[model samples]
Each structure stands twice: as C-alpha cells, then as structure tokens.
Target: MARRKFTREQMIAAARDIALHRGAGRVTLEAVAEVIGSTKGAVLHTFPNKLTLLEELLRSMCQEWDRRFDEIQSKTTGDALSAYIETWEQSDPQAPSYLEAVAVARAEDPKLLEPVRQAYQRYGNLMQLDGPIATDALVAWMACEGLVLLDLLGLHRFDQTTKDAFFSRLKAIAAAHNGEGT
Candidate 1:
C-alpha cells in the first residue's frame, strides 16, 4: 500500500473538514493526514506546525468569504439585500468552518486572534459598505454570526418563526439604509 500525497490546498481543506466534525481543539496534523489518506509527517512537511496550518486555513476561510461576497454583490438586479440575506443565512456550508472554530479556540490558543481580526476587517470591506452603510451592514453581519454561534453552542434555538422575524428585521434595516423608507 502507498500513501497519498496531498497538495497544500487539499491538506488544508481536509484539516478544516476535520475541525468542523470534531471541533477545533481536537484537530491535529495526524487527524487531517488520516482524513486525507496521508501521514502526519506529510502534513508537517507542508506546514511547520499546527498553528501555521490553522492560520493558513483561517486565512483561506476569509478569502473564501471575500470571493462569495463578491459573487453575491455582482448580482445587481433585484434587492441586493435579499441576495445578501440569503447568502449569509446559508453561508456556513458555503464558507469554511474556521470562523466557528475561532470562537472555540479564542480563550486558549490566541494564535487565532489575528486571523479572525483580519477576517472581520476584510468582511467589512467585502460587504461593499462604508460609513453609515458600513454600520448597518456590519451590525447585520455580526447579528447573523452571533446567532449562528449561539446555535452552534446550543445556547440559542431558533425556530422558523424566530428565523423569519430576525431576517425580516434585517431586510427592513437594509431597506431603511437604502433610503426606501422601510
């Protein structure tokens, strides 16, 4: 039997998938290599250490969001807000699981701090928002993030009704910001 060689990209993706399934602290070079059919030494050759791998995965996650936000922003026909809303409501699957992992790792590792900060900064940029526009969109984005984290932590349960009301309020905020008098 022969071991597979994973590209830097494949290894990172596998690491992210592992973290999402088992949670961040449990993710290890061995775990990722196992998932990718490679070896711990193989992963180490690519990434100097776990923090290095996690940092890259975290950055890749942010870049993915930047890409997706650009895609959604390009659609200009109907309410961009609606597209934005849907984009985020379904973003976890579309984006990497690294952000959720960051929340989990924040209290201990602290290596995650910079990447998550950079991610949020880029997020504000990608939202195509500035000044007051930035305020509303940032709040909305944070609200979505907080709710998603709460759900992930089993602290908050959102039924369909609550989801609808929250989204409705978000849309109304966007509309108001657009000066449509929502």
Candidate 2:
C-alpha cells in the first residue's frame, strides 16, 4: 500500500483536530502521523517539531478567521462591529477550539501567544475605525467577546432566543450611533 502524503494544510488541520479533541498536550508528531496515516518522518519533514507544528496551526487558524471576516465584511452592508457580532453568532458552536492551541503554546512558551495577541490588537484597531460609533462599537465588541469567551471556555450557553436578543440589542446600539435609530 502506498503511504498517503499529507499536504501542509491537511497536516495542520489534523494537528488542530488532535489538539481540540484530545487536549493540546496530545499534538505530537507521531500522533499526527497516526491520525493522518502518514509516517512520523513525514510529519517531521513538514513541521520539524511539535512547537513548530502547533505554532503554524495557531497562525493558520488566526489567518483563516481574518480571511473569513474579510469575506463577511465585503458581503455585508452592515458596520464592522455588527458584522463582527453576526460572524460570532453564525460560527459553528461545535467546531474545534482554537483556544486549545493558545493554551498549549502558552504552556510551551509565553512568546508563542504573540500571533494571537497581534490578531486581537488588529481587531481592536479595526473596531475603532468608525469615529462616531467607535466607543459604542467597542462596547458591543467587548460584549460580543465576553459571550464568545464564555462559550469558548464552556462556561456558559445561551439559548438561540437569548442570543438573538443580545445581538439585536447590540446591532441597534451600533445603528443608533450611526444616526440610524433603533
């Protein structure tokens, strides 16, 4: 049987799956090879080491989110904050946790959080681009972040009705700040 050769994307996805399902501590090269049905040497050839593999996975996840946000922004006539809320609301609740990557990276080296931190800083900057709505937008953004953080940590679950009300209220706030009254 010919061994399946996994692309970089496939390997990173497998590593993320391993981390998300089994806990971040389990994202070893050997484990990834087994998960993807490739050799340990094949995994190493792509990632070189566990830290490198996980770091790339972290970066890839952030980039993917940014890409999705850009796509959302381009498609919606809504303001950035409202679009952000919608994006969060529409995300898959059962998707693999990117937070797992952050946890593992932080444990290995605090510096590994640089990419994550930078992505957030960029998000903050983007939220501030609207002059009139900046403050209210940030409030909405923080509120959305709180909800998302709680969900990500598995600390809270709001029913769809409650979430709809929450997002509607935030959207109204953003609209009001733009002179479009609720």
Candidate 3:
C-alpha cells in the first residue's frame, strides 16, 4: 500500500477537531497524526512543532471569520457594524467557535492569541464610522460581541424569544446609527 498523504490543511483540521472535541490539552502531534492516519514525523514535517500547529489552527480560524465577515459585508446594504451583527446572527450554533481556538491558545501559549487580537483590531477599524453616532455603533458592536461571547461560554441564559428580541433591538440600533431607521 502507498503511504498516506496529508496536506497542511488536513493536519490543521485534525488538530482543530481534537482541540474542539477532546479539549485543547488533548491536541498533540501524535494525536493529530493518529487522527489523520499519518506518523508524528509526517505531522512534524508539516508543522515543525506543536506550537506552530496550534498557531496555524488559530490563524486559520481567524481567516475563516474574516471570510465570513467579508461575505456578509458584500451582501449588506448597511454599515460594517450591521454586517458584523448579521454575520453573528447567521452563524451555526453547532460549529466550532473562537472559544475552542482560545482554549487551545491559552493552553499552549498566550501569544497564539495574537492572530485573534489582530482580527479584532481589523474589525474594530472597519466598524469605525465618521459620525456622531460612532459611539452608538461601537456600543452596538460590543453588544453583538458580548452576545456571542456569552453563547460561546455557555453563559447565555436568555430563551429563544429573549434572544430574538435582543437581536431585533441590536439590528434596530445598528440601523438607527447608520441613519437608516430604528
């Protein structure tokens, strides 16, 4: 039989799956190799080290978030804040979240969060509008992030109705700040 071939993306994906399901502490080069049906040497040939693998996982997650944001922004008639909120609203609840990446980063090295921080900084700049309601826009953006954080941390206590109300209110606030409507 021929040797199994695994791409860098496949390695990273296997690491992500391990981190998300088994916890970040469970993700190791050997574990990833096992998941991908390869050898630890094969995994290292691609990642160089466990830290590199974890960093790549976090970077990939950030890149995926940027792609989703851009896709929503392209279709949105409102401002960046609105696009950001809509993107969160449309996210898959069962999908892997930033929390998983964050856990892995925190477990391996705090510096792994740099990609996440940079992504937030870029989004922050995009959400900055030139108007008196800039603060309102900021608040709206914070609220949306807070909602997502709560849900990710499993601290969200609001029922579906309350969550829907919160989203509706957030949309209205974003619209009003954009000078569209309340």
Which one is best on TM-score?
Answer: 3
lDDT digits (tens) for residues 1-182 of candidate 3:
99978999999889888986787888999999999998999999998999888888888877777788889999998478888888878777645556556878999889888877777788888877558877778788888778877876678756779878888888888898878984
The residue-by-residue lDDT of candidate 1 on 1-182, one tens digit each, is: 77666899998788777666677776678888889887899999999898888777777776776566557767743445545665566575435644565753563388677867776665555456765566886677677777777776668778978888998888777676656653
Rank by lDDT (best first):
3, 2, 1
In candidate 3, how many Å is residue 48 off?
1.0
In terms of lDDT, model 3 sits at 0.82
Superposed model 3: Cα runs more than 4 Å off = 96-99, 129-131
Return the lDDT, model 3, position 182. 48
| RMSD for each of the candidates | 3.3, 2.4, 2.1
Q: Please give the lDDT score at residue 146 for candidate 2.
A: 85
Report the Cα lDDT for residue 124, model 2: 70
Model 2 ranges with Cα > 4 A deviation: 95-101, 129-135
Best of the two (1, 3) by TM-score: 3
Q: Judged by lDDT relative to the true structure, which candidate is superior, 1 or 3? A: 3
lDDT for each residue of candidate 2 in 1-182, tens digit (9 for 90 to 100): 77677899999888878766786778789988999988999999998888898789888877777676778878876456666767776777544333544666766677888888887778777665467557787788788878977876678989999999999898888677556784
Worst 10 residues of 2 by lDDT: 93-102
